[model samples]
Target: MDLSQEEPADWWEVEALYDLCFAPGRTALSSYRLRDDVPPVAQLCLCLWDESDALAGVIRYWPIRVGGQSALLLGPVAVHPTRQGEGLAGLLIRESLKRARAAGWARVMLVGDYPYYRRFGFEKLEGVQMPPPTNPDRVLGLSLTPGAWTGVSGMVTRATPQAAGHKDATDP
Candidate 1:
């Protein structure tokens, strides 16, 4: 498999892949409520491809604020059913975070399993809060820079930046 930046042409396929990989009502979940209003963090979206060029996995990030502090929100990492356990998801997480850091983003947060995400430097976010109806235990975060999460408190809200429209690796 090959890991590459996702192009706009891949967006529809990626959405289909996510639909198939996740449950039917996945988008309505409380955690996903934030996604409906924010654009994806184009620089951080990654795709994994198989030999035939089929999308095997995908990961995306979005701009968000915690207590008015800028941060990236990672989510909806989906692996094709046939390609599970090949480490594509983890690879995407690492590569995307590397790109995010290189692009000057200092923090990222996600609602996910603590055990799995901890390997990627994510820890319990003491000062971050997701929209209501989200489980506290699933809320986690990581710092790309030293103490990036320090003093970042309050509800997680979407931040719509004008530069967000600019192209990054993931753009077509």
Candidate 2:
């Protein structure tokens, strides 16, 4: 299998994979609220291709803020049905996370099941809150640095333009 950074050409195909792997209303989830109109962390968004060159899996991360500190919001990762059980999802996740750490991101969070994500070093975060209707138990985080998540808390929100490495009116 070959891995590559996702390019514009892969958008529709990646979305299709996400659609296939998630429920019809997956976009309605609270996590989507934070991702709306936000470009993903370009280097951390990855695609996996099979020996036949078919798209096999994808993963994405977005910039977010928790208690005003920058954090990565991981989500929307999906693998083609044929790629399931082949650990393609794991590969995408691990690779993306490694890239995230290298890029100086301190922490990452995802809304997912502990049982499955635990293997990836994600654990339920306490004192942190996501938008309503989201189960807190599903809010998990992994620290990319020692003590990265220590004392972090509060509602997760869209990353400020500055925090996302972009400039908007909010920045001086």
Candidate 3:
């Protein structure tokens, strides 16, 4: 398997992989409502490829504000069924998070199972909130910088209009 930043054209394949792994109603979840007007933060994306170059897994991050605290929202990580249990998902997550930190992002949050994300330093977000219909227990966060999450609290929303267009990194 190969792990690296995504390539522009690989996005379509990643989207396909997501469609297959998740139900069609997946996007209707409350967390997605916040992303309606926001574009993803391109720099932190990572994709995994098999020896034949077929897309095996993918992960991406978006910029959002929790109440007023700026943070990255990681999501939509998917691995092809045929490649499950090979550690591709973890690899994509680890690499993407490394990229996120290198780019100066201090925090990240996600709506996912606590058990799986805990390995990456994500813990329940005490003061951060997601749109309705989302269970609070599943809302997790990680601080790339030590104590970065201290005092950060509020409802998470799409990034401000100004930062929406600011993108410093992209997949090769």
Counting clashing residue pairs in each candidate, in order, gives 1, 0, 1
What are the Cα lDDT values of the candidates?
0.82, 0.86, 0.81
Runs in model 3 lying further than 4 Å from the true structure: 167-172
Q: Pick the winner on TM-score between candidates 2 and 3.
A: 2
The residue-level lDDT of candidate 1 at 136 comes to 87
Instruction: List the candidate numbers ranked by lDDT, top first.
Output: 2, 1, 3
Candidate 1 C-alpha lDDT tens digits along 59-99: 98877767877778897899999999888888989998889
lDDT of 2 by residue, 1-172 (tens): 9999999889999998899999899999989988877777878889998889888999988888899888889878888887799888888899888888877788999999899899999999998999888999999999999989999999998875555657211121
Estimate the lDDT of model 3: 0.81
**Sort order, TM-score high to low:** 2, 3, 1
Q: TM-score: which candidate is best?
A: 2
In candidate 2, which residue ranges exceed 4 Å CA deviation?
161-172
